[model samples]
Every structure is written in structure tokens, then in C-alpha cells.
Target: MKMNNVIFIMGVSGCGKTTIGKLLSEELSLPFFDADDFHSVANIKKMSEGKPLNDTDREGWLKIINKLAIDQSLKKGCVIACSALKEHYRFILSTKLETNAKWVYLSGSFEDVYNQISERKNHFMPSELLQSQFEILEVPANAIEVSITNSPLEIIKIIKKQYMKSEFGLFGLGVMGKSLTRNLANNGFKISMFNRHVAGVSENVAVNFKNEHDELSNTLAFDNIEAFVNSLQTPRKIMLMVNAGKVTDYVIEDLLPYLSEGDTLIDGGNSNYKKTKERSAYLKSKNIYFIGTGVSGGEEGALKGPSIMPGGSKETYESIAPFLNAIAAKDKNNLPCCTYIGPDGSGHFVKMVHNGIEYAEMQLLAEVYVILKELGNIPDEIADILESWKASASSYLLEITIDILRKKEGDDWLVNKIMDKAGNKGTGNWTTIATAELGVSSSLIASALFARYTSFYKEERVQLNKLYDKQTQTPKITVAEVFETYQFARIVNHYQGIKLIAEASKAFEWHINLSEMARIWTNGCIIRSTFMEELVEILKETDNILTNSVIVDQTKSLKPSANKVIAQCALAELPIVCMSESVNFFNGLTTADSSANIIQAQRDYFGSHTYQRLDDESGAFYHTEWINE
Candidate 1:
């Protein structure tokens, strides 16, 4: 095995990339270059002067680094140190560099790096400037992360071993690798870390000793890929934690050989579910199990209790479910974190779907807030309203969002700091894609998604702003009328969005256990609401069970006020989508659209058959084919 063609010691500045890059290069008898050295004098001057470099400023530096890596690839491997922070930046470097570069992402916490940088002997960069570097650093996903806790030499040896094992290989070492190794060891399952350098596997995880569970601190470390592969227990499972980009792709290639039949590669990142499904299928054909799982609850969530959605072959799930479920988040029922949501990319797929629903639910709430603030001219007291709603609501996420909206940091309300520009992870987009693929019209959900996108175009919205421009529908003289109108709007939005979810489920055959879905959303998931239980009951019975029917029947005799409120709301603002629920209540109750003889005639015309008397046993075809023409 030869050294990697290119090695990058990457992280926020002051993480020892330069020192380690040079040391490793000398050990391998390879030429080493400080990535900082390649930066144009101007860029460094800006950083040293305490200003952040934007995308344009970093381009030339990346080009130079890429050229250096390519130039060194022809000979023995080379090492360079730079803060290759963003996914796009890494893409450019990886694409341009000819060398098969194995990244060494220097890992440390804010305190660890701050203390180190503060104590440095002589550095032009101030500790104050360190935050900017940390802010810019996008930790490389699927790279060989070298946690700085061990002596620099131990880290170096760990990487070197992996490099020597493969002619050229990429090892993914991070969150999962670190603790997974420890667990494997405990289970007598040998494992490998596989960093590019000779160093041990890096625990890229930020251990919170506060939890009193050191499981976060223990992870597998392999000297190298060869060592990692050689030490693999039968049915090896390597879980990845890096970002989901080209680096992840590169690591999959790196681990191809180390995996044998029945080996499982679990992509434990926020990867696109479709790709996961495809990859899982391909790996399975080669007799490897690829589980695309959605891990929620975050770092501590991962260390102790995260809700893990695992999807793959059932056999594979059985093999890993025990361990995964043990670590995943628990619900009120204390069910394990591991849930077999579906098949193929089902776990990740379900997660994406879950997130999409979350996006829609959140956006809907924001719409309510906007209505309250701009439309109703009400003071922003989202927490108060949300708190009251929670008594009747089960949506755990919404409850928190409400609290967040109510929270005030300093004089500023958190909702105020949250730019109206609603953002999204690809899950919302993925949901759109899936819904489209399934031929389901998720109009309400899609509208919610678009609503967030529209919020981002604040400046662009100047020309098309509708809050005041579209209409001047004056409020009624009564304050009671104003409050009543606003409440109606909220109710309408709620019913419409929920109705769409039910309609889409049927159209797509998601076979969603609406009751369970609602139950989960009540706490850990989004869209949990007190009214959701009622909605679940309605949907669980039959498709014809309408929301308005229940409202009208229950409240009509007791509260004429309820009917008057709906009537007043209808006259006030015409939220068209919401009309369907009310329309359903009066659907067959009215004599307008349903007459017995009229219905019979319509049925006969459409079916080309004549309706017989109710007492008759059979009907006759009209035989009006020629007669009608």
C-alpha cells in the first residue's frame, strides 16, 4: 500500500492542521504544504485583519490547493492543511485535485480549540477571530476525522495504518465510528477506524459528560482501512456520520472491499433517501446490507436515545435492530428508537416524509402568526396562544415552536429574530418529489412549502406585496367580530391542511396508520395536536366522516354561536380551501343537489342503464346509443 495521493488536515484554524500536516508529510517522506501558504496574500490579510472571506475570495485559494494536490499525485502522496469548510468548497477541491485525497478533519469542541488557541505561543490571529473560523468550518462528512485528544503521534499512526493497507482508500470515521467501536468491543466485535493518516480513529463526536454516560466518548478506532477491514467481525457494519455530499460517495467506494457478504453499511447522515434506497439495493445485490436510517434527537440523541428509522432487507433490520433500537429515542409508550417504517429506503424515506410534514405544519403555524400580526393587528403573544392550545393539542414540535416564538432573548422576541424567510432542509423538497411521483396532489402541503419560500423573497416581494395591496376589506365595527373572524381563519387553515393530508394518503397508498402517525406527532414528531386525536378518529372510521359534520352536529343545538361564527367567518375572508369542510356538513343535508328522481336519471345516463322502480329486481340498458345521437 502507498500513502494517499493527497491528504488534507482540515478544520477551523488553530486545530493543529498545519503542524500535523507537516509532521505527517515528513514521516511519509512526502512533500507537505500549508493550505494557508497557497492563499493569496490579500485573503490572509483580510482574515488576519478580522474580516470573514466570502465565497469569491476563497475560489482562487481553492484553485491553488487543487493544483498543488494534482501536482503531487504523480509522485509519493502529499499533505496539505486548509479550512475546506463548505460542501461546495470540498466538491471543487476533490474535482480539481488529481490526487486521491483522504481528508483528515481535525475535530474538537469550542472550549477545546478556544483554550488551545488562547494559549498559543505567538499567533497573529486573535482568539476573538477564532469564532469566525469555527463558524465557517463545515466539518467534512465521511472523512477520517482525527480527534485531537490523543497525542498527535497516535493520531498520525492511526491514519498511516489505514493508508498502508489500501493502495488508495477513503475511510469514513466520525460519530458512529468512535462509539460503535467501543460497543463492538463490548460485544466482542472487533472493528477498525481507518483514518488516512497513521493515527487512531477520531471521535468526531462532541461528548457531553453532562449526561453521565461515557458511551459518547467510546468509539472504534482503526489504524487504517486495512486494519479496519482485517479486524472486521463477521457481518461487519460500518455506520457513517459525515455530511451527505461527494465525500460520502468517496467513502462508500473506500469501504467496498473491506465489506464481505452480509456486511452492512449504514449511512447515518441526513442523506437523500432515494440515493440511499438505490445504494442499499446495489449493496444487497452484492450481498451487503445497506440501511438508510433517519437518526433524530441529535448528538446526545445518537449517544443515548434517538429515534432511528432503519430500512433495508427485513433480515438485515433484524440483525441490527436490537442494537439500533437500544440507542434510539423512546416515546411515551417507551417503544424503542428503532422503527421498521417500511422497506428499501423506507426508514430514511419515512423520515424525509416526516420532515416534510413538519415543514408544512410549521409553515402553517407561521401563516397563523402572520395573520395574527399583520392581519389582526394583534400583539405577538404566540406563547400564550400556544400554551392554551397545548391543553387541547398533542403536537410536541408545535408546542415547542410556540414556546420559541414566545421566548425573548434580551429585548428581542425570538420570533422577531427568526427572519420571515422560512428555510428548509431537502426533506420538504423530497416530500414534494415523492408526492408528485405518487400522483397525489398535496396542494395544501405544497402551498405551505411555497409559503416559506415566498417569505425569503422579502425584497422581491416589494413589488407584489399583497397584505395591503390586494384588498382593503375593512373590519366590522365590533371587536367581537374581529376576534371571531381571526379564530375562523385559524380553524379553516387547520382543517384544510389536515384534510389534504388524508386525501394525499389515500391517493398515494402510503397505508399510513393515521392513528399511530398522529400519536407519534403528539410528542416527538411534528403536527401533533390535541385536535389531531379527533381528526384521527374521523379518518379512522371511513372517508366520508367530515370534520364540519361533527362540529355542526355537536354544537348546533347548544351553541348557535358556533354556526354564526362560521357564517360570519365565511362572509369575512374567503379562504376557499377551508370551504370544503363546511360544504361537507351540508353536502347531502340540502335538497339542492340531491333529488331521488334526479339522481336516478344521472346514474342511468352516466352508466347507460335505466333505473327500475325500487320494488323491481333488475334494471334494463337504455340502448340509447343511436337514439341519443
Candidate 2:
């Protein structure tokens, strides 16, 4: 009963494609589709007139077929008889179908196909046009090649015999890996799950997972790396969900021996972007495709749907887009939260910035919580207030914070019992480093990361508090003022984060579509929100968020409250690192005339560096001395 979700009976005209496809569909109890039925009237006319259609002509037709295949892939498998002649045409037809699509090429001599077409009574494809198809035919090497001379029944039998391999392969059966595997299986993609057998650690990890999920009849599990690789269909798509660094490399090295030239390897970890670039180049030399994809949302998101950011060769991305999209979270418009970011490492870089923004957002929430606590509101009341802000400022982070604040263990607040120290898993650090390296302004992200580092010195902070006799008067800040401050800081956080991404795109020639990135972040990501939905529109208007009228008006209205909160927090001896930096970054960015002239003068006086003169029409550079040595 093992079968591809989409069986494409492909060949030039008059190759028994329809005959074989219909027979196969009946045998598999699947629906059948003819590519000709979906063609536009203009296309039919062009072909009927014996004129060959160009790539541009077939582009829309191919996309329509691809969409049909993707839709059918989520339901019962379908059999499609298509003249998927050129390699690029086949690629387009299989866009979202990925490994779930299998090709059955009807092979025959040109003369034989021509004779069969000449004998046909009624068909839109004329025998005269058959020669053009043959001329454009880029035969697929990975198809189940059956001679057109064979009976339809015999060809179906051969196809059934060869289509037993799983649609996709997943290596690493840890938390994220296992969740993704189940997600793929649930989406009707036959998947092979693999995990190295480590005694006492992960013995029979994949095998046990398969046994536990008996309903996942489409899956095969293996502790043997060779067996796992062999279980996948050709142009094998294997995603590595292991740890980012040495573990990912070691697993890749082990799998390399078994992988072929056309196979693709995906890293679904928070690996450093530079490392991703290195691995991508290395794999390209080996003739293997490497994709560095960022899978956001935690365990629940993985099992349900996560926002997927995949970057690699555009061609390579097409081979795996369907499988990723099928398991990606849907936005309000029901579009998958996945897109082809760009070439090598860009996905990871976007994800790194995403995590950095996540840090700032989380710290913003924490600061709000502390301010509320200082103003004499308990955890429960604070949670309710935050819950009320959902209509305007709702986000995944905010939702989770509300739950965490409301959580109690035996009448004692669990959050209160927890330590004040915060922990980060390197992505936030990587974000700050990338921002600095790219010379982008990311003070909010940097301040958030530094706050975490400072929190690590819990003992030092406690000791210093006593030495300084740390005490604070309650800040005269209303909930409305605090909420406004939160809104303003969040707007600035997103602006800075997007700016960093925009700068990196310019510096590295990534050419990332900020609008698409915003769309993907509208769901399944930690920073997803109503604000992201608005941002999706704003980014489409301009790259600089501050310039948008919506952002400008909102910031203008919220600026007074943000200023008051910062001033009062400082006077009350309370720390608001991320919020303070957010306001400061905004102030610095908006300043038309800056005091940097003094710094430039100081540098010129000491180091003899040149400075550009604002008064000079020709933009002349000059250096001056101040004090006589």
C-alpha cells in the first residue's frame, strides 16, 4: 500500500501517459488528473496551432499544476499525467509536492511516439507538435522509466514495485526532531526516521518512536545510518535536527558516505550563520545540496506547525519546500509561515535576529512586571492587567508570560520561587555579535543580552545592593502609562531588529524580502503578534519602519508615556535596561543635529583622522588640532 502522494506520469506527447496514469490511479484507489485539462485556453490554442510554448508561457500553467498537487498531497494521493518535458518544468510541477511526488516516465523512440500521435483520432495535442516536445525533452534520471510499448497494467505493476521508499528522511530523534517527524507523517508525507544507536543514551531511539506511534503507518525507523539513507526516495531529502555545532557536523560526515550528488541535507538547528555558509560551500563541492533552515516555535509548534525559514540554492529549496510548508504554521490568511529566504546562511541569520528580538521583547515584559511589582500589584493582578492588553499588544511571549505569572504551586507563586537569573542559549549573543559585525544599530538587543549577563551575577548584585543601601520609592506610573511604554518599546524593538536584518541583507547581498519575513513571523514565532500583521503591511511600504506614518503616529502618541516611565524608574532607583535603551535608540535615531561633531573633532585632534564638514558644499574632509602639544 506504500505509494507516493503524487504520481506524475510524465513524458512527451502520445507516450501512453493518460493510459498508465488512469490505470495506476484505479489500482491505488486514487484520483486522476490530466495536465491538459488544467491548461489555459491560450496555451491550448498555441499548442493546437503547432507553436511551441516557451518557459514564460508554461510558467502559469506549471504553477497551477503545482498548487493542485500540493492540495491533493494533503488529501488522498492523486495520479497526474503531464508532459513535464523539461527538467525545469518538472521542477515547477513538483514545487510543494517534494518527495511525495514520483515521476513515471513513458519512454519510447521518437518515431514510435510520433506514429502513436499520428494515429490518434481526437486530441488537442497534434502529431505535428510532438516533434517540439521531443526537442525540448529533458529526460528525468530519477523516474521509473517504463517503455511506452508496455501494457498499461504492466507499467502500473512496475511503478508500484519501485515506489516503496519513504517520501522524506529525518535524522535525530530528540525533542524537535521527533515532533517534526510526527508532523510530517501526519501531513501524509511518508517519512524515514533515523537516529544513531548509542548504548544507554539513545538505544533504538527511532525504532521505539515508530513502535509507539502505530497509527503512523507511513513511517520507517532505523538505528542504522545506511538503512535510513536507503529508505528515502532518490534526490533524498534528509533534515538534521541535532545540536548545532560538532554534533551536526559529525552526523553529516557519517551520512555523507551514503548520500548521492542530487540529495539534499537540511540543518534544522540554531547553527551559526557563518558555519552554515561554510557547510553549504563544502557540500556544494561534494555535489550535495545543503539548506540551513530555521524552525521556530518550541515542541508544540514543531508537532503542530512552526514558522520555517529555509535558505539555500533556490533550486534546492524547491525540492523540499512542499514538505516544509505542509508542516508550517498558517497565518490569518491560511498561508504557510514558510518562505525561501535566500542563498546560504540567510535563514539562520534571520533566525538569529529573531532570537535577539525575542530577548528584547521578553526583557520588556520583565521590566513591565517589575514596575507593576514596585507599584504594589501582586502577580495575579499583574497577569490580569497584561491579559487585558492582548487586544492591542498581544504576542506569543506576552501570552506565555501571562500564563507563567498566573501559575501557582500549592498557593505559592511558582514564578516568585524561581531564581531571578535569566539564561540564554547563545542565539541572543550571536544576534548582538552579528549586529556589531554588520555595523547595524541594535542597542535594544545588546542591552537585553547584557541584562541576562548581569543577571548571571546574582550574588554580586545582592552584595552590592546591601553596600549601596538599595531602596526605591514607588514610581508614580499608572497601568496606562506602563502599557504605552510597552507598546513604544516593542515598536522600537521590531524597528531595530528589522533594520539589522535589512543592513545584513545589503551587506551580504542577501536581498531578503522584509515583507515576506514579516508575514512568516505573523504566526508560530515567539514574536508573532497583531503588530507583526501590521508590520507586514508597513514593510511592504518601506524598509525603514520609522518612516511609516502608522509607526510615526503611534510612537509620537506613546513617546510622552515612555519618557515619563524612564524618568520615574530612574528616580525610583529601578533598572529598565532594554526599555531605557529602546527610548535612547529612538532619541539618537531621530536627532537631526547630533553631538558626534565633538567626538569627530576629538578623534581628529588625537589620531589625525579626517571629518566631513556639514557646511562644505563639496563634502570636503578636514582634520584640525585643538591644544598645542
Candidate 3:
């Protein structure tokens, strides 16, 4: 299984083998070879007859691949392309290699490969024999399987990570790992990783680890857990992101003794909140530093630096923030991808609630999309509508939606081909638990998460089709003009949500920055808005304005249009209705309680302690009508 100095770019002929392999070799600074250029006259003649290649015909080809591997092992790196059609052929060549090497499997489905084959005229292999190639094909569990669907440049970008390193010992190494490592190395962070298996890591990674070079490079290796830990520069800060719960416990139990007192452990996984708190306390009892950071942004976001919500000691979180921020995605103002949410389980708790909001926002967006696509029958210009809406009521989510409409998935559009099914993790469930404990309500986020859960029941939905009509009642509008109104509404909802968070901060005594939080989230995390820069400046000009109504009163001119976003979301068919509902929920606090009248009545009834009111010069509450006169 140790590839001895042989990098094979294996796929059927039409898979950009020659072109991509050449680029890969140049990028990795390796030699290049192609198996297509090695075909014998007899083999070409038999394959031109539409006959399938057998094990006998492949032996010579496999020998050539082995020779190429041995020859390239003497040099630094090499890229060789071959129709490594069978498990046995790959097995023979890997066993015969002189020094360790890698294998990049350029792969696609049979239908896709056959289509490419059919287009070629001068190729020795006929299209009729495509099935036989698939029949012989066996995907090695260890091989780096590069999908053929992406363009050569995208593939090349992924491959560029092959020569980079990840820092601070982190999560999954597939898309997330590669992207994180590449970005961090690009930003100058030395990283070490632990993996259950070693196949995916390359020789460059192994060399980087051994040499202890100062500047970042793709210094990595897949090793046994114990060995991997031993290889690290000590007083280690290991960040684990395997599955949550029991696996976390298992890894912790195993790693406890090996780590010293100054060493730290950060759980970057989505573990339960209570569990994280308990685990942190437990680690502290053992004199170990424990941190729980909540990471969001899917694979792309993770690797590209996600919005990280870290909670632990004031010490440990601060220690890691520099590296974490360096790799995280920027907000609108291009700040780091993270914030210190607070102490104890605050980071995970915020993350759980953040995910809850994510669920609601996504569900709301989906509902609107359905309303537009199914009900409005809007055509190819979905991007334009999304763009117009963003002029005022803008979010990164909406901006991405606009851009997504422009993407093509082969002959069909990506937005068009997507199924109604959505995915949900358990964060919404966690939010429900937390909200119940804290005596608060968040119906919108909860509803959105539940909506995704319901997406799985297509069978039930189909059965329900008999009972109810799918037709939706929709209000028509000139979308371009309505966006101006919607933009105002979005800004209102955003500020309201923010104010609610500020209220929570005050009630719970977290003392979070309303403005800095906005600035920190300007680039990397979800919910980024273009207004964050101005919002931060507003905070700088008048601190605590969100909590101060005198300043809020000063915004009377902006209030009418600002409050209209909620009104619009309600009247219009957009999802901001939930957002609008929150506004009503929050602003409704000033309703007529008449507590002053009641208090005065109580005072008069009890001991004659008076109350002052309109048209009163002195402080007094009238005991009787005659007394008032």
C-alpha cells in the first residue's frame, strides 16, 4: 500500500489525462509520463477491432508503469497517466515501485467515460469496449480519487493543496482539510495532523514533518494515533473534529496521559453543549486546557477558513485566535473568521443557536424559492431578481444565491436540478433545549430546521397529493420595484435580530460588542452584510446606541423606512415575515401597562404615598374626587 515514488494519474483516455498530468507535474515540479504513448502496434490493432483488453494484454502495460515508477523515484516527483484498469494491475505496479509515491485517480462514471470515448476518432480503443474497462476497474480505498466533473483548473487548484500544510492540528482532510491546510500554509501557519490511515498524505507531507522547517509547507503524514502524537512539537494543542459524543470520549481517554499540563485540547466538533462544559471541567480537573470551538461553513467554508465560535478559558482561546483568524473566511470588512463567544459552553451554545438560525433562514429561502419557481413561473433571470433585492435588504446568503443562478451544471443549471430535499444536523434540537432552559422562544429557526427534516418524506408528500392541491396563492408584483421596499425590510429585521442579541447579552451579562461582532463577521462567517462597516462606525460614534433609546429616538427619520421591511415581509410573500414578526414581538414591549396608575392606586389605598402625573405641580395621588377638586 506504500506507493514507492510513483504518481499515477489513472482514468480512461478522454479524462484530460495528458493535459492535466502535464500541469500536475509542472505544479508539483515532477516528471511526466503517459501510458497512451506506450501502446504497442499489436495491442492498438486488437483494441481498434472493438475487443476488450484482458489481463494478458495488460501485464506488459503494468510492467511499463512499474518501470516508470522506479525511474521517477530517483528524481523528486513524477506524474504518469495510465488506464490502470484493474486492481491487479495497480497492485503490481505499486508493489514494484522503488520509493514511496502517490496515485491520483482521475475518475468518472461509465456513461460519462463512454461519451468521451465515442467522440474520439483516432484512438486505438473503440467506444464499444468501454464497459470492459469499467468491469476491470477497482477503486483503491487509499487512492486520491479526483472527480472528472470539475474543470482542469479547479482540479489543479485542489492539487495545489498537495504541496501545502495545515496548522494547529484540525479536522477532516478531504475537501475541508486540503483547503484549510492550503490556506493556512498560504497564510503562514505550521500544521500537524493525525489520521487513522496514511494513504491520502504524500511524501512532501512526510518530508515537511521530518525536516522541521520554519516556513509553512505541506508537511503532513498519516500515522498511527500514538506515533502521530509523538511526532508533534510538544506542549501540543491538538484540535479534534472526529464524530461527536462517544468517539470524543474515546479519543480523550486515549490522549490524556500523553499530553502534559501546559498542553491544550480543543474540540472543534459539534458536540453537545452540556457534554462540552462537562468535558472542559473534567479536563481542568486533570490540569489540561480544554476548549470547545464551534465551526461552521461546510467543507468549502471549513477549508477556506470558517466562522469559528470558540469558548473556553480567556487564556486558551486567545492563544489560538491568531491562527484561527488567519485561515477563517473574511466578513464584509475582511476581518478574521472568528470571535470569542464567552466562557464555559458559550461558544458551542452560540454555535448551536447560530445553526438554529441557519436552519430557519435556509427554510425561509427555500419557501420563497418554491413560491417563485412553482407559483410565479419566473424564468432564467432569477439572479437579476436576487441582485435587485440585495440593493437594500442584502445578505451574503442572498448575494451567493444571485451568483449561484449564474452557475451551470453541465447542460442543465444547478439551481434548476436541485431536489427539494434539504439536510439538517441536530443544532436546531439543541437550540430548542437551550431556549427552553433560558425562557425564550425562537420559532423561526426551529421551524426552518423542522422543514429540512420534513424534506425526507417525499413518499408522504406524494400520498398527501391525493388529499390537497399543490397550487399556492401568490401575489404578483413588479419584482424590481418591490425589492426597494424589501431591502428596507431586511435592514430592519437585521437590526432587530441584533438588538435581540444585545438584549440577551445584557440579561445574561455577556457584554458582547454589538458593533465589533458585526465587524468580526464582515467576511468569514454566515449572515455577513455590507452594512457592518457603517454599523461599526455608528457604534464608534455613539457607544451603546442599541441599548440607548435617546439615540434610537434620534433615528426617527430612518425608523419609518426601517420598520417597513418587516411590514413588507408580512404583506409580501417573502420569508422576512418571520423577521417582521420578531420586530413586532420586540417593539411591542411599550404597550399600555398603566402600572403607574395602578401603583398610585395601591399607594393611596395603603398609606397615602402619592404619585405625580400630567398637570400636577406637586407630588400627590388624590384620595377622593373632592380632594382632587
Candidate 4:
């Protein structure tokens, strides 16, 4: 590997390029070359006469250096000290090299370089020519930029840390893939990108990404899967950000031939956890590692940083933790909002629940907006109220909601002009199904999903609006009461969602840490909020949060406000389905007694289904022989 690690230390004269190059050559046990030695007699004499060397004079000098770089790179790798000041010069020097020549730019102020030049004991380059070199220098964005502020040893350490033999590979150059690729490159990780081309598209997304980010030295694009796989270092790490299901499976199968044992394949999409589990097991049988990673936050978050949840073998996660954590969102404490969730589908499972809670929260917010608007508050006034709510219940969604409320197109509010229909991409439904499978109550999330479905009946709703003639006054509800109601609903929504997750943890044997999950959701993800931070602390105190005395006390105090808000919305003939269902769920779960006993008797009498009596042993079933009156 060292034989293929060709390095170029580049800067203006007096920036210590030659010194650093020699040191690097010795450190890495490679031969060193100074571009000055490759200069022609005429070029050397011209510099000896204290004259500035122009592009014409430097052309031959660059060719010689290029050949040396190519030749040495093919052999036992070499370090070259070159003042490759211009981008064109660097290009010429690297054009023929099969592998990228790692260019390290030693950056410093003109004053600093001049001072060093003035103090030089003996050199062909004159101090007077230093100014011209500085003037003509074109900084390479593709090169690693190292400041001269640190000692030579420190600078060498920086360069060594920045340069890695093999880079990460990404498949699928879609929006999420492109954004994540850029994010990784920005963090100084070399990334190899490949996209399966489809006809009719004028430009290839992978090609466009390469062209747009040409200045990023660490990013490489490939059209062939074979070459892309081969370009990655041994024990290769590749992430698939393609469509879920069969497409993901197809990509894995295609790449499997090229991948060796211990290499990892990460699925960073919204794949079904069951599919993820199957893939992980399959890959394990082949001696390759599979990670089912859940990446939250959308395109913008991908470009910046997102909360990352990686689930697979603990050893596999450890191998990729450095890259994952380096590119993950940081909280207020500067900790990455990422962690190893568990084995198999735990990461994706957590993400599914995150989306589920996102659905409920959005529905709750929409209900609040509708209630306030029905109460005759203008968009601007509602925006103001939402802005104030930030202090009490701060979240990324809330901030965006406020901005959305304030937006206007000409004389009309954009929200008012938009269609009433809502859309989802299946994660919400997935959560609903998972909860049902676990026999967990997730009425708030289920109600939210149904709300979107009901919204799709646009024609029916319009006709119903025209036919219905019932008139009613808007129920009086204070803004404070409405706010209190929203807060309460949010708690209930999160509570039910968390309960579902807890049940899943037990059923799946994931042993998920609820507090840690809450902490990870406090940033980057769509459902991130100040509320989650508080919830994390609360969960640490007790595992059964629903039955925790502190939460129970809070719920008791907030119940009246929720009831009032629900009553007013109902009186005003507005639907608060999620909130109403959440209240119902809470009531049903907390109630000590109910009418289910009579229903149980009916079932026993009709079908001979056994029912447990209150006075009987808990596990014992009894059949009653009763006569119907």
C-alpha cells in the first residue's frame, strides 16, 4: 500500500515544501524529488538572474515533474516538493497519474513566506521573485490545505490524518445520496460515487456531481460498479442509498461478487426492518458485514448533518463509527446525535417510530393551527402565537411552521392557496402496522394516518360542505388554553409512541435504551425538540414513564385543559381526530374499571369462549353456563 501512496507537498518558495517533503519521504520510507532539480538549464539560469519564471518557462519543468510523479507512483511511491502554484500546473502534473497525487498545500501569509525567504542562507530563488510567485498562485480547492501556524511535525500529522488509502464508496446518486456524498467529502473523507444510469436523462447525476464539486479532491465518480468497488481500500465500506426492497437487494447481489470477506455493505434507506434483518443474516452467512442504518433529516439535513442510527453487529458498527460519528449532527454539548441502536433492524425500526411520531406531531400542530384560525386569528397573528410557543415547546418543525405561516405570495398567504390534501411515503403506515402487530396502542399515530386518508376525499368533502346547513358559533377558547391543549396532546402522542417502541424492544429482544433514543432524537431528525431533551431526563429516572409519579402528576394537571380544547373544537364542528383519540387512549389505559366484563360474558354465552372472573386466579379461565333472558 505504501508503494502506491504518492504524495506531493506544494506551496510557494520559502513555505518549507522541500523540508516537509524530505521529512515525509523519510517518515514513509519513500524517495523524494525537488521540482527545482527537474528545471532546465535556461529556466534555472533565468531564476538565478533574479527573474520571475513565467508559464512558458515552467511548462517543460512541470512535464519533467509529472513524469517523475507517474514513474515513482508506479514503483515504490515517492514524495515530491513542488511549487505547483497554479491549478493548471497541478492539473498538468496529475493528468497522467493513474492514482490521484495527494497534494498538500502549505498555506501561510505573504509576510511569513517573505521573512523566511529573506533569512535563507543560500537558494537559487530570490526574495524579490517571491512577491510574483505569491501573485500568480492559484490555490487548489482539491488539495488538502494545511496552515503553517503549527510546527512541521504537527502539520505532518494533519496531512497524515487527512490522507487515507481507501475512501468510502456510495451507490445511488439520488438526492439523498448526492447530499450525503457531499457531506462526507466536506468532512475530508474521500468518497467514490457511482450511479446506475437510465436512458433519457440529459445529464448523469454522478457526472454532474463530479463537475460541480471538482474542487473537492477527495470525491471520485465512476460509471462502472466494478471500477468503483476496486477503487475502495481493502475491507471496503460501501453504503447503498437506493430505493428500498428489490432494488436494494439487486444492488447487493451485483456487488457481492466483487466484495471480499469482512467488507461491509450499509443500507441507508427506509427499508423494511424485516428485509433488513434478512439481509444482515444473509450477509453474515457469507462472511460479509451488513449494517441497516437509519438516516433521519431530509435533503438539507443530509447536506449538513443528520442524526444517524446504525444497527448491525457491535463489531461492524465499531469499524464504521469514526466515519458515522464524524458526519453526524452535534447537540448543544457537541456530542454526535448518533449511536449503535442494536443488531439487525433496530436502527431502521427506531427510524420508523421516529417517522410515526413525526406524523402525530404534525397532525397535532395542524389541529392547533385550524383551531386558532377558526377562532378568527389571522395568519400573521397565528404566526406570532407560534413564535411565542417556541419558548415552551421548541422544535425544528415548529420553527419551520412559524416561517410557513408568515410566508405570502403577493396579496395571498401561500398556505391558504395550497391544496388541503396531505401525502405520506409509508413510514407512518409502517409504524401503525408494527404497533398493531405488537398489540400496542398507537391510536394517536393511527388517527393521524387516517386523517391524511380522510383528507384525500376532496370532492366528497366539498359536496358535504355544500349539503350541510347546520350553523354553529365558534366556541370561545383562550389562546393560553389552546397552547396548553397542544402541549398536552404532544405529550400523549409521544407517550403512546414510546410505549409502542418499548413493547417492540421486548418482542424483538433489541433491549433498546429509551433514554438514549430520546437523546438521539433531540437533534437533526424531524421530530427533534427541546421536549425530547426533557423526556430523556425523565426516562432516566424511570423506565415505566406512563406510570411514573412525576408524569402522572403532570398529566392530572393538564387533563382539564385538553378536555376544554377538545370540547371547543367539537362544538365548532372541527375535527381534532388525533388529539381526541389520544385523550381516549389515555382514558382507556388509565381507567381502573370498564364495561369489558359484560362483553366478556356475552362472548362466553354465545361462543363458549372462556372468560376470567375477577375473583378467580389470574391465569385461570372459566366458562359460565347462563340462560339468556
By descending TM-score, how would the candidates be arranged? Answer: 2, 4, 3, 1
Kindly give the stretch of ten consecutive residues in candidate 4 with the minimal lDDT sum. Answer: 94-103
TM-scores for every predicted model? 0.52, 0.88, 0.58, 0.75
Instruction: Write candidate 3's Cα lDDT for 359-428 as tens digits.
Output: 5555555544543553355435666667766665566677777677778878767887877677666777
> Against the true structure, what is every candidate's RMSD?
22.8, 4.2, 22.9, 15.5
Report the C-alpha displacement of residue 552, candidate 4, in angstroms.
2.7
Q: How many clashes (backbone N, Cα, C below 3 Å) per candidate?
A: 33, 0, 21, 0
Q: For residues 170-250, what per-residue lDDT tens digits would candidate 1 score against the true structure?
A: 134456434433333333222344554532443322222213334323334444565666654444656776667666678
In candidate 1 the C-alpha lDDT for residue 516 amounts to: 50
Candidate 2 C-alpha lDDT tens digits along 1-629: 34346889999989888888889888899999999899899999988887888999899999999999888888887999999998889888887565677788899999889878788877878888777788889877557677878777777777776577776899998899999999998887779999888799879888788888855666988999998998887778899999988888998899999999888999999999999999999999999999999999999999999999999888788768878888999999999999999997999999989999999999999999999999999999999999999988878999999999999999888999999999999999999998889888898999999999999999999999999999988999899999999999999999999999999998889999999999999988878999999999899889999999878999999999999999999999989998898889899999999999999998998899989998888988997767778
True-structure Cα RMSD, model 3: 22.9
- lDDT (tens digit, per residue) of candidate 4 on 531-624: 8888888888765676778678877888898888888778888898988887788888878998888899999999999898778667799987
Whichever of 1 and 4 has more lDDT, that candidate is: 4
Using alpha carbons, what is the TM-score of model 1?
Answer: 0.52
Clashes of 2: 0
Best-to-worst order by lDDT is 2, 4, 3, 1
